[model samples]
Target: MNFKQLGLSDDLIKILNKSGIADPTPIQKQSIPQIIDGKDVIAEAATGTGKTLAFLLPLLENINPKSNEIQALILTPTRELAIQITNEANKLKEFNDISILPVYGGKDIASQLKKLNNNIHLIIATPGRLLDHLERKTIDLSKLKTFILDEADQMLLMGFKNEVESIISKMPRKKQILCFSATIDSSVKKLAYRYMKNPIEVFIKQNDIALDAIEQDIVETTDRKKRDALCKVLDEDNPFMAIIFCRTKRRVDELEAVLHTRKYNCEKLHSDIPQNKRERIMKSFRNAEIQYLIATDVAARGLDINGITHIYNYDIPESVESYIHRIGRTGRAGESGYTCMFIDPKNIKDVNEIEDVIGFKIRRRNVEI
Candidate 1:
């Protein structure tokens, strides 16, 4: 249905039409009305399912344009997601006078402090940085009207549970809470039970974890031959754009170096890189200026790029959930995609676990490396 039917304001409807967002996704259709009605909601939706807009649209609707205080707080697991949400909010608020500030680590805290000192209406932040501000009294969430925990599962996975709880403890008591996550584990449920007041549950079951459009396959190779096997797969597939998932920063650096020396247009993303460079790399990758991006799991989450034709698992992820998230990057927006995993003999157990989680066997293929 349309945004107007979702109880959004006329101005927001006009803005969404101009931005080419005429209809809402399943999650948006289910959760936006409840959220706009000022109810706590717990949503279980996968990545790339238009969830950002699901919470963002209702958030913009509830915001008071006349208030100079921070009326809304959005806590994300990564700086990338905070920035992405902030960018989306800025785009939607182009015709309005609302001010938003994204607070995350790896950037200039002084500049963020200056912005915080201004009449910011919404603050999209990571838990740690928000705690820092709360401790320093740079941010006053006493006036916060709405609180959102985007990617709650990711936050818990990243060891921010205590920090998130602490941040939540500092918000106004009577404010509305909205939580959106890819999966609702026991911990997520406990968090919701503890914080949310009679929350509405919304689950959008799409493909049951693995996208049907993704062609999943595995290439068995030894540790020494994985690089050559990956090269062979790349040559055979000839993807328009791809992300090569490595397990560590060192591996990403080494792999990116090797790929660059081989005259491949590629870049590396990891925690060691500066935030500005990482943002630039993400922008380049989104624009298809870079064909290959070698990244670790921490660096890859919250990447909402479209048109990714391939995903290369240069290293098997540590968990089944991570594998799902990595492959979910591709096969988005109804486009057919491919995922090739170079599995060493040692990580066969991990692959098996992934297969068990996805409830299917991945096609195994041999490449002459």
Candidate 2:
């Protein structure tokens, strides 16, 4: 069904229509009406299922613009996620002068403190920074009517359970709680039950959308020779655009430095980088100005850039789903793409698990550098 039929406000509908977003995804279709009606919800959704807008569009529709209090608060696990959600909220601000702020580290505190006085109606924030604001009494959540935990599973995985609980305690207990996560483990369920009031659960399971148009390969290399293997693949493939996924921020930084020394057009993206620089790097990558982008899994969530021809898994993720997300960055809009994963000895089990899900043994290639 269309977003208009999902019970969104007319203004939001017009905005979405103008942006060429006519139909709603399964998560959006299920979650939007409930969220708009102020019901608690727990949505089991993946990153690419348009989950961001599922909560965002309804939240915006239900926001009371006349109230100065921070009517809605969205807590995220990482700085990049906070910024990404806020960027999305900003795009819908044309309706009734809605004020939304992104509260995260690496930005000026004084500037944010000043903006806090404007009475931001909605805040997309990381748990730590939002807690900082709470402790300093610079922002008040007492009037918050809706609390959304985006990527709830990631927050728990990042060890932000205490911070998330503390933030939730500060908000009104009767407020609507919406939790969206890729996986609904026991931890996420506990969090939902503790704060939410009999939340309505919605699950959206998307098949392997990337497997059709993408060629997958496994490159066998030791950890020491992984860099050389990556270089050899880049030289041979010479992709128009590529994203190299690392498991952590340190790995991204280290890989970017190595690729730079080897005279490759590359940049590193992680939560530690300044917000402005990250935006610039993403812009450059989207414009095809950068040949490769090295990023962590958290940093690359919600990234939807077309023309990505190749994906490189420099450090294999432990889970099968992360493997899918990393490679799914390519092969968009019916465009053919390629993914090369560099696996060391210890990563054999991880690759085996991933192969089992994909239902085929990926073609193995030897890298001699």
Candidate 3:
């Protein structure tokens, strides 16, 4: 369906067309009308399914353009997601004059404070920094018409439950609440039950073709031969750009050093790296300045890059959901991609769980020693 059929304003539809987004994704098509009608909504969709525009379009349509107060608040799980959403918002409002600000850690608070003092119509923030603003009394949300919890599960996983609840408490009770996530776990459901006013629930079934587009394979390797196995795959596949997922920050650092010694153009991303450096690395990766990005899950979360030819699982993620999230980096926008996993004997059980979740068994390939 198109944006106009979803009841979006002509200006916003024109903006979307200019951005080359003529048709709405399933989530956007289903949830946009509900949101524009001022109904509270809880939407479940996977990563890279265009959830950002699903909520942002309606938000732009619903807000009073003339009101100077902060009318909408969007809380994201990480600084990258916050900035990404803010950028999308800016693009949609290019022809319009609605003011939007993205507030997150790793930036100067004074600058954010100055922006807040100005007439801001929408604020996208990380939970912790938003709380800091609240504590300093530097921003006001009394007139907030809509509150959004983007990536609700990730926020709770990062131990921001209390901070999120506290921030929500500061918003007006009459405002609409929208919770969007890849999965509706217990914590997210609890939050909805406690706070939302009989929200309409929308669940977009996972696109089977997108999952099928990813050619997944596993290589059994001993702990000592894992690096050799990784090199063998890279030698054969020669991906345009690939992201290697390590289970820990230390592993990422170690792998990056080894790759550099082997003369591979690569960079590492994890919580230990400074936020500014992380952003630079992400930018470089997106521009294909770097051929490989070695990262931990936290650093890779909410990354919305395209043309990823392959995803390497150097370490099997701890959860089935995490494995799905890791592989989802590729095969986006109906493009075919590959996922190659290096599994040691110890983590074989994790692979089993992943297979169960995906409802198919991954083909095993012999690692060239």
Candidate 4:
């Protein structure tokens, strides 16, 4: 359905139209009107399904621009997602003139403090970083009308429950709560039960049949032969953009160096790098300046890059969830993509778990190097 039919104002509908978004996504179709009515919602959608804009639009539309207090609080799992959400919010507020701020770790607190003094209306923040500001009384949440948890699963994975609980305790009880996630487990359900009040649960089952447009396969090799097999696949496929997932920071560093020596424009991402450098690397990768981004699970979560033609799992993930999250990066926007896992002999059990979770057999493609 068109966005205008979903109860969005002419200003936001005009912005969306100019931004090339004529139709509302499934989640937006269901949640926008409910959010406009000031109700709690729990939306389940995959990456690249425009969940950010779905919630951001409603939040912006509901904001009382005259109030200087924080009207909406969007809690994201990572710094990248926080920044991205804040940027989307900024786009919709061209006519409203809302002051949106993104707060996360690895940035200057003094600067955040300076921005907070300017009548902040919306804050897209990571839990720990937002908690820091709350502790220092740097942010005022008394006028909060809405609270959103973006990527709820990842926040729990990052062990931010205490921070989330603490922040919620300080908020006004009458606020609307919205939770969005790619995949929800029992723990996430429990979080919804405790925090949200009778939220309308909306699920977009994209991943079940989502990647019919993409090709998925596995590359089988022993530990000694895995590197050679991956090299052979790269030579054969020659994808325009690929992200190689390594299991550890050291492994990512080593693999990035190896790819660099092989004359590939590759970048490394882990917890070790400075925030500014990480931002630069991601910016370059998104702009196609870098061909590959070798990263650990922590570093790769909540990324919103499109047009990734391939994802090479240099090391199989230990859990099924990680496997899903890793591969969900590619094959987006109805584009065909490929995911090849360099599976070691001992990692077959982990592969099986991934297949079991995905509820299908992952095709194994033999590489003759």
Q: List the residue pairs that clash in candidate 4.
A: none
Model 4, span 1-369: residue lDDT tens: 777777889999898889877887787888899999888899888776778888988888889888778899999888877877776777889997689899999999999999888988889899888989999999978778899988998789889888888989889978899999977778888987787888998888755535666677898888787777878898899888888999999998877777789887789998789888998998899899888889998888778787799988999886876676778788876777789898877888888877776768989898898
Which portions of model 3 miss their true places by more than 4 Å? 207-209
Q: Which candidate leads in TM-score?
A: 3
In candidate 3, what are the lDDT values of residues 207-289, reduced to their tens digit? 43277889999999987999989988988888999999998999998899999999988999887788899888888998999
Badly placed stretches (over 4 Å) of model 2 are 206-210, 271-279, 365-369
- What C-alpha lDDT, on a 0 to 100 scale, does residue 27 get in candidate 3? 89
| Cα distance off (Å), candidate 2, residue 83 | 1.4
lDDT of 1 by residue, 315-335 (tens): 998887677888989987668
Clash-forming residue pairs, model 1 = none
lDDT of 2 by residue, 229-255 (tens): 999999999999999999888899898
lDDT of 2 at 7: 92
TM-score of 2: 0.92
Q: Give Cα distance to truth, residue 257, candidate 1, Å.
A: 2.6
Give the total clashing residue pairs for model 1. 0
TM-score of each: 0.93, 0.92, 0.96, 0.93
Q: Which candidate, 1 or 3, would have the higher TM-score against the true structure?
A: 3
Location of the lowest summed lDDT over 10 successive residues in candidate 1: 204-213
